[model samples]
Target: MTRQRYRQLRYPLIALALILGLLAIHQYRLYASPVTAQRVQTVTISNAGFLPNKLSVNKGETVSLMIVNTDIRPHNLVIRELNVQSSDLKPNQSATLQFLAEQEGQFPFISNTPGYPEIGYQGTLIVN
Candidate 1:
């Protein structure tokens, strides 16, 4: 096409491209899996061990746990089944763990911080 025709068609072409891009995004969102809510559950770690240690959530949902280590020594939160482990948080330190609950089952978590587990630093995460 001539330069004049090309220039005249440019705006329409750009508009078409924009519309196509938006349609692609909309289609993707329609076919995509629904996003789970960002819910947070806090657990306090101290001499008393995990407060409300029996955590529960729905399957296919996301799990976000705020682990507050209120003890003088560092502690770790580990879920062997999910291979999820939190850092050895120092005294009064806090950490957050986020993961998808892909499976439905009862998973046990432990603290691998030197006798912490034996001291009652154990809990269960139930995904239904």
Candidate 2:
């Protein structure tokens, strides 16, 4: 090729090579990143207390707990160990608590709503 023609193509060739390099790096990152397991569990709150009062998950997994209030009062869920809490949910209302189960142990969750008995409005989260 003539010198003039080579000069005209040089910039575009470099740009194409840079773009391909960037794309290759992006694909490598997507492949090298770890994939975490996601879990969604639904818990219903009623006069009888938390339905399925026990939850279990594996370590390093993401958990999404959907809490639905089906009783005649408002309530909230708290897991101090995991630093997870949900907004007060009125009767027929619902809330979702999301967190990573990084620790492997049994954690207790409870509703701190006034006038509610802690004994009945509590549950255990078992992380393995």
Candidate 3:
């Protein structure tokens, strides 16, 4: 190729090579990282409180808790031990709380919404 033609193609060739190198690095990282299977648990919220209030899981497992609100007012769920909290969900709305169950013990979760009795809206997560 002529010198002028080479100059015109140089920048674009460098950019293409950089883009390909980044993509190859990303693919390598995706494959080299460890993969953990997630465990899903559904908790329904109502005036009566959380259904199936007790949840059990193994230590080091990831948990995806789907909280569905079927009540007339908004509410949120909180797990103090795991530092997990859900957004205020309106009627017929839902939110998900995900975290790694790293500790082996019983963690309590509850709805802190006003006017709801703490005793009535409480549950436990048992990790073994």
Every candidate's lDDT:
0.89, 0.88, 0.87
State TM-scores per candidate.
Answer: 0.71, 0.70, 0.88
Model 2: residue 6 alpha-carbon error in angstroms: 21
Regions of model 2 farther than 4 Å from truth: 1-37, 115-117
Candidate 2 all-Cα RMSD: 3.9
Locate the minimum summed-lDDT window of 10 residues in model 2. Answer: 33-42
Show the lowest summed lDDT stretch of 10 residues, model 3.
112-121
Better of 2 and 3 by TM-score: 3
Q: Which ten residues in a row have the lowest lDDT in candidate 1?
A: 113-122
Off by over 4 Å in 1: 1-37
**Model 3, range 1-128, lDDT digits (tens) per residue?**
89999999999999999999999999999999755547579999988989879999999887889999998988888987789999888999998777888889999989987745465788999999
Q: Could you tell me the TM-score of candidate 3?
A: 0.88
- Cα miss at 46, model 3 (Å)? 1.4
C-alpha root-mean-square deviation, each candidate: 3.9, 3.9, 2.0
Clash count, one per candidate:
0, 0, 0
Identify the leading candidate in terms of TM-score: 3
Superposition TM-score, candidate 1 onto the true structure: 0.71
Q: Against the true structure, candidate 1 has what lDDT?
A: 0.89
